[model samples]
Target: MADISLLYPKGKEVSTMTLTEESINDLSVDYIVESLTKDIYEKNSIKKILTNLTCDIDVINYRADVFEDILNFPELRDGLVELLKKLEDLRELEKFNKDGDASSLWQLINRLREIDGYVLCITMLKNILNTIPIKSQGLLDLKQTIEDIYNNGGFDILKKDIDETMAKAQNLKSVTIGVNLDSVLKPKNAGVISLNNFEITNSGILKNFMGFTGSKEELNSDEKVLSSHKLHPANPSLTRMKFGSAQQGANTNVHIDTSGSATGDDPLSQSLKKVVTDILKRMVKSIKATLQKYVNISGYSLVGLMPEIIFYIRFAELVDKMKEKNLPVCKPLAVPDDRVAYGEDIYNIKLAIKRTKGEEFDIIGNDITFDDEQRIYVMTGPNRGGKTTFTQAVGHCFLLAQAGIYVPATKFNYSPVDNIYTHFPADENDTVDLGRLGEESKRLSDIFKVATDKSLLLLNESLATTNVAEGVFIAKDVIKAMAYLGVRSVFNTHMHELAHHLDEYNSDDSYRSKVQSLVTGMKDGHRSFKCEIAPPQGVSYAKDIAEKYGVTYDQIKKNIDNR
Candidate 1:
């Protein structure tokens, strides 16, 4: 359980099923994730959330609201990011407590420190939220919880007790020792002594030993006890006592012991160890008593939200980056029940990422309007004319829009799709198992079995690996299925004949959305990469390629004359 969930709405269980890898690859989803999560902290965790993206309308709307709040109020996002940075690993605490492993006093102290950090984080965030405005419903709930916890009388009392206990623990800075030893360098007894502001200096001892030869008025006070022998007359004087030195001659080895603390943690005498242990025992008991009441609070549960916080912050950063470049990004309006999707000035987001990485290029955005009239599009264009790029762009727009982040478009509005099905070209290895055409047909069949009228299908150069006659024959049937199924689709292909026969499929009245031909255009005999609602210009495409390579009749004649 998380203290705050930025991804999900309160009390809503996110569905488990997600778009398949085939669909993700067809839409270039992995590329999108990589681009968004770049330069983000805990990037792996962020990627996990992105990889498991949901297509649920409510979930998407929930995320969109949270992202909107973050984008609107940057200070709040920054504060939350900073607060999340202080959270220690909660799993470690759970594991330690689960095993009841308090074998050492240091472990107990560390646990207490972690708890103290959590309390401080919560209190500081509560105070900071007072100045920052939060609009998201989920965040408002979290804020209310924090306020309630802080205003409760029991919480204030517990906090005060913790502060006082820590102050006492901090005051126990140094320990004094009293040791009793036998004649054989063995300890018999030891105890902690009250430590004063004891100073070891030369002049103080000398002044006490040889009283100052000053005026009689200065010496009239009580005489100081100069020697230990005088102070303890009954005990024998051991002022000149000398112990055996560990130093050996020139050939002797003097290995330095580099381990243990300077405070005699690994003392050579057992009596000294006993004294340190006694102090630690007392300190641990006091700390345990202070923390006992707060142990079950599960404050570490807050750390579980660190990764989610990073996810939102990182995407917000990318949104800012897109804004800095003067690119168009808009908040999408989701109409889940409408069963229609459309966007104006929609551009390929993957291209935007490349351009941001210093790739020099210009982008021309295309507008799409899919409704009951034109529900499926048979897109055809010349090679390298951005047919696949444009198709993938539509899918990317939907994914980004529903994720609640700013999409790379000027305007976007769409109904949420229940799922996305893709029929891109198969991998080379897939052909080994079932030849290219067989595999493509099988995958298409699989998609139809799962896809519904509310699904989105993106097909890129599908069914073109076989001969033209065979390809067109199979593509015609596929287009018929799309029309009858009434799903939104972009079937970009080299088979211009298939795109030319859209009227044959649209004549059927039972079809929910009419099929239309969408061609990638040419301007001034150059590839424009601009998609338009028109018939495929196959003859024009061939002529442009011939003239570009000096293969036209006039160009060939001129080349021969020059030679």
Candidate 2:
């Protein structure tokens, strides 16, 4: 028997889908590239982008390989590493020299030098360390040692040793003629015997009295006698002992054993050995310290370059794939100066739209320069002739230009609008039950709530479903309100009577300069339009649009002919 309630707890169960790791990785990469391109395209810091890209690629590749436990993916690692190297090379080029021309190359060279030095050393160490094999107790012991050292501030000790060793080596290079000692020994008979004045030679020792011979060089005549003396009685009567010199003319070749009981058990040989060992240890520590410092510095430096490096690598890969498929590569066209200048001048868009389906897309000409003067533009155009598209294009262009991307026009001149508010083609299902008009009113209200004098408002057929008179009244009031608030607005409507009404209102000297109309083309086959700030002339294209929507043009012509 099954319990139905227990089988599905909480009455109902909903299954949710989540993005897989691969999908998330791809999205992350895309986001990184997009964000980097948007942020750094005009900064000329291409190297930074490349560095970031390479770092991300390395991280992803490493993660994938680890999770899959596949060590044979050398190609994956190599490709990423190669891209990183290239970016690193480029970054180096930027910091090479201080002189103008030479400086660029020097900058690159310097950066490469630093990166190569740090990367090579650290990678070599990691590879070497990873190759060590140990089993059971030995492995555990080694692991514990490493953990203890790393976790308990062992680096500081190593760092100090390194500093001391380097300094000692630098001092040692200038000195010569140091005393030599063999093994230091202590005995009750001869307190502490110093093994000094002994010469080690390849042909065995030529010392006095007790010389021992062997196939290999053993204790020489002088070293043997000295050894014997340390084992002798430590009384003052046995003050000195002597041995022969391997070299005949050298007086310092004879070994001397001294029983200085006051010297304690410390041997000269032991002290020298400790000094030398300490020096060597210090040297090793210094090298490690330098390498660690390099890692720290380079890690921080590479962080800044990650974004660009990642993007370029991906973009290059994309380009390569496209080429392999023999596909056309998309290239951005050069932005025109007129557009940039127009963008500098206008507070509002007169008419701005990109290429739309079945529409001949060209930006209309108008001296739409709005500084502190003439900020509002009320446009009346036929439906299906591009009112919404134009508004969107204008807003998009401004955004793109400000973001340092190319605008879609021969020329652009406009002011820098603080914000761009749009009310166009929203999802009907997403709208509240109060209707599209109500939703639009709310959107407009929100816009007004946040909009400032420097803000731009783009309204497209905003109250179209309402009565024409009410719509016109609302539009007029909106425009008037915007004007009073010193905010710029571009209103697109089909109210022909509203144009006349605007004309009447403009007849007053006060409102004349504030309001203006730039009419879009009527139904014409020319596929081009002109814009001017004057009272609209010629017949309105509203009825034509209505007829076109209701019946085919050919049918309309036939009906006309039959009539």
Candidate 3:
């Protein structure tokens, strides 16, 4: 079991990062993950998988293949879901054995019920294995292993022991309790002195008065009479009580007792309780001896199936939702490590979420490419002009691609990054202790310290918390560092001046990455939200805003005349 993992390859160490809640929120990764897993899984558990995005391509592709196979076979997915639900209860069953407490008769009954659950789980798996046509090696291996276990003698032993034990457990019909009383009629002692006939639960006067002499073939399936030894108890607390004398049965003992008040608890009742407890202990010991081996081996393997089941169920649900909504989700081609990172028809997934929520707004998709000539983009645009949206979209696409899911784009190709680190602006409340600018600078420095050339950086208004002069000065150094490190990045900002030194940064032969300017376009006084490779538009955005608002001198005069 130690060598098994649904997410990781056998013998390969699982490597992942512990992203902070702030970082997760900053990138909207939580939003995307929750949206996909909504109504399918609890938010907290689903968020864990989203935060721990794998940097390993092999593991990512492996899970993707497994997800595809699940999506292809609806019956397989449904079967696995039912099995996983039953398997989820196994955790509670496992806890009973973790502590060495003695089992009560009542507790033993509950264990029998859980054992029934285990029996059902095995039968369900056997049926599923026989039905689903699994293609992925991960699922195929699981199927083969389950088949082997089913045919093993251990499985037969488990079935036989469960049947026999359950039969024995069920055969207790009724108990007759006898209590000794004092002068005040208080019970001084109590014991089960006799076992009675099985109680009839159903009440029908005609049936009680008359006996049916029907042929076996004429009786209904449920109408079969219980044999003497096969009689079952109505409840867990009731057990067969053996009496020493048949002469004790009389109406005289049913009269009220005039016994005196008892000074202490009944010793007879205490003795009887111990007797029942000891009997329960022996029964548990026998059952454990018969079933422990199969439980030890099969229980663990089933537990290990939990994560694999969750992964398939969540992804398959999202895939179905996307198909129903006609959203575009395409498989990405993972480019080699040394190749360029690029995506076409790239759109922000956040917009897709809005559309799913019944928003009628149109979502515009853009394209981005990161190659030797333009590895770092200094994106500048007016506020609300889609700079932040486009920057986050690029990061989301890469993260989706690496996770081996369909990207939001129609086509995407990416060199896998070691990790993604985001530096979206901190909230005023978050920066209050350190002051806004100070906190921003500290986060930027931390990002630089850990980031590598193979990492993808998503910077959204990072240094804009400070004054223009200071921000531009610091932004230049950060851009220079990014270029020197040769990492792929999108630094979207309101600092239009940051785009001025592109030629200077590109001229440095020591710098490994080229710098380029990107701007969100404005057409006919309306924000187009289309990002492209071009120089900054500068004050033209303010002029466009004025014209659109009718605040320009000529537009204002025309508005006044029309009014």
Q: lDDT winner among the candidates?
A: 1
Deviation from native of the Cα of residue 70 in model 1, angstroms:
1.2
The 10 consecutive residues of candidate 2 with the worst lDDT sum are: 1-10
lDDT of candidate 2 vs native? 0.41
Shift of residue 192 alpha carbon in model 3, Å: 5.0
Writing each residue's lDDT as its tens digit, candidate 1 over 417-476 gives 777788888889888878999899999999999888888899999888748888888899
- CA RMSD of each candidate after superposition: 9.7, 25.0, 10.1
Candidate 2 lDDT, 319-341, residue by residue in tens: 34433433322222222212122
Clashes of each: 0, 47, 6
Give lDDT tens digits, candidate 3, residues 454-499: 8888889988854789888888999999999989999998898889
Best by TM-score: 3
Q: Candidate 1 or 3, higher lDDT?
A: 1
